[model samples]
Target: MTSNFRHVALIGKYQASSAGSTGDSSRQALEDIAHFLERQGCEVALEAETASNAGLTHDYPSLNVDEIGARCDLGLVVGGDGTMLGIGRRLARFGTPLIGINQGRLGFITDIPFDTYQATLSPMLKGAYEEDLRPLMHATVVRDERIVFEALAMNDVVVNRGATSGMVELRVEVGGRLVANQRADGLIIASPTGSTAYSLSAGGPMLHPSIPGWVLVPIAPHTLSNRPIVLSDATEVAVEVVSGRDVSANFDMQSLASLLHGDRILVKRSEHCVRFLHPQGWNYFATLRKKLRWNEGGS
Candidate 1:
């Protein structure tokens, strides 16, 4: 959905994702992004809760996710990559596009750095930035075939051991047929856009953002025969915790309370898609090169 620019919403880590010095640094980045977006001709909007913790003292404060999504054209999400995933899920329905500014380590999704905002995002606000459309996955964690928690993940939906070190035994099925049962750390159901995130960490191969493919990658599978499998966007995948050696999930780390043992995760291509604004002439591999230091030196 292309449109002329009007309202822009900003979301960030007001509290902390980790601990200690990392938390302090995240708070600072949140503040900087707010000021930067304001200077970029976009009024800042945030949850009342987020604003207070970030020491945000703006007279013209903003609204929360629901209100901002309804009114904003773009959401400028700041923080680590996790922050962008939260914003994307919270405001997924508004058809609102997002631009992420990376503030922490290993920001695979939030590819843009704070320093490059003006060079890449300015033209975007003026309706000049290019757009990349990626498919999102809708997941339902069920028990007894009854829906428990329904959520959206731009990356992968993982079912793995929680605190235990043992392999999480899972039974995978596609279109109601059994795929395999093996022991592993976890299983990753990832979108192409998410291939570089935890899925990659779990040994999944990197995929082009343009390709509409989903990957089933097992984390350190006990059997060598259990390899990463690619499926079309049309295939629906069902996974049940046949035998949970204490397993849990993290939906982009938004809410950990919902993930528990005996939970079943049903993943399929979602009707919703997230639009990303890239600078003119932005290339996927080129961005990866600079961000991942593909050919760069050991600094």
Candidate 2:
């Protein structure tokens, strides 16, 4: 079949060790997928870090993330959600669409199963696919009116007290209006795409990806009445560390430690969004049911 994506970038989990069992399997999968893409009339390139960590020595060109973003029409991420999250954030700026092949547990965003990837991916290459646009959150840590750290999160932005520290006091604001002053273990500012991640575990609602909203969930709040609240994505949310010991902020996998009093975490919707391509007829609810085992005991 003729491919809609002529130049495709293949990214594997770089953290996998070449000598480990998982790495060996991932390497084999990458090779097989590369060959399959070739047969589909698509030119494939290996992501530089994937090539190095997987010990790949294929004739295909190995390119960095910037190169892939500029040149490739599609990015096929072969790993778990974490791998996809890392690449998604990087590729969002370039507007390059992505497809995820599940190589790790709890695929979530990486919904394609390895065993059936060839069957699923072939049609997608031929323009038979579903497009999903997931929004990203831009988080910044501001201290004393200066920007200290900044990152993009596809999941959630978290603020937490140190492991040994007591509860943190955070003053929350939305659109420059005071929302609350809560004493809690921490706070989570999660985008719709992040609703099912850490936020879900912290008692936040599971928001559909199509929702244009954010969920604020407090972790172990001292007040029982403190509950998760959803707000429109158009507004900016600020969380200031009013009082805490060894506080920190985390944006998805990226973290900034040693937060002091008055350090404010600013979160807003990013202008760029990640685009995911799935097989035609893919349904978000179906994915949730399958992954969450919602029908495990159904007849």
Candidate 3:
């Protein structure tokens, strides 16, 4: 551990390859950005699968996400918010700081826009910015006392009805106590880092970035009683689907889609944290104001 790093990993969206012409455009951005970093005197390592998507024969270094995070001072993620989730989860493993350049709209996670690539990245290479510590959530989607799909998220973990109109029922528990028998399209448990994301879309409250609490929001609940609830770090929360003929849960809304029945989901504050490299004088609330469109005395 060098207290900071020099080698960096660059991650992008492989799923977005089907985004019509936008896919080709996204792929090109990755190519241009990697070359940009190399020119900046940074050793850039890209995800192996990304090479395949680019139709390039070059091999990515044999490195897992954790290894990349451990070895690299930073992880630069290109593409949409989904790309941020993919790399953010892995970066949590070794507590690596990430710099996201948004190539997508709103770009809650991908805060820095592509147009500011040079301006935003130049200071980072020269070690000239502050690290905003962002919390991460660890989720385990399990069944029969066995781990099925385990992951960490800077945003949220979703347990939803995949490709089905019927709701997915779940009994919510906090610290081993029953909270609610949820009847909804799905459930979202998000960190403050994720509060602006799916949780916000699902009628969850907005949490300040440094709030140090977790938000549990039900997606499309059948009853109005179920509102998004925030919990402290010490609490242990579990969600178990009551019963279903065809049940599925999506972690992070998209990826880790369609899990099976009898699954018990566990969510907790991860021991690890994610540090983001922000432009100097970064203001979390000010950024939120711009993204959320909080007008003066208006909607």
Positional deviation of residue 33's Cα in model 2 after best superposition, in angstroms: 0.4
TM-score of 2: 0.97
Each candidate's root-mean-square deviation in Å?
Answer: 3.9, 1.4, 3.9
lDDT of 1 by residue, 175-197 (tens): 78899876888888888877888
What does the lDDT read for residue 153 in candidate 2?
A: 92
Error of 3 at 33 (Å): 3.0
Report backbone clashes per prediction: 0, 0, 1
Q: Note the residue pairs that clash in candidate 2.
A: none
Model 3 ranges off by over 4 Å = 1-5, 16-28, 55-67, 162-165, 255-262, 296-299
Clashing pairs in 3: 5-73
Better of 1 and 2 by TM-score: 2
Clashing pairs in 1: none
lDDT computed for candidate 2: 0.91
- Candidate 1: misplaced stretches above 4 Å? 1-4, 16-41, 104-106, 257-263, 296-299
Q: Write the per-residue lDDT of candidate 2 for residues 141-212, one digit (tens) a residue.
A: 899999988999999999999999899999999999999999999999988878988999999999999999
| Best-matching candidate per TM-score | 2
Worst lDDT 10-window in candidate 3: 54-63
Model 1: which ten-residue window has the lowest total lDDT? Answer: 252-261
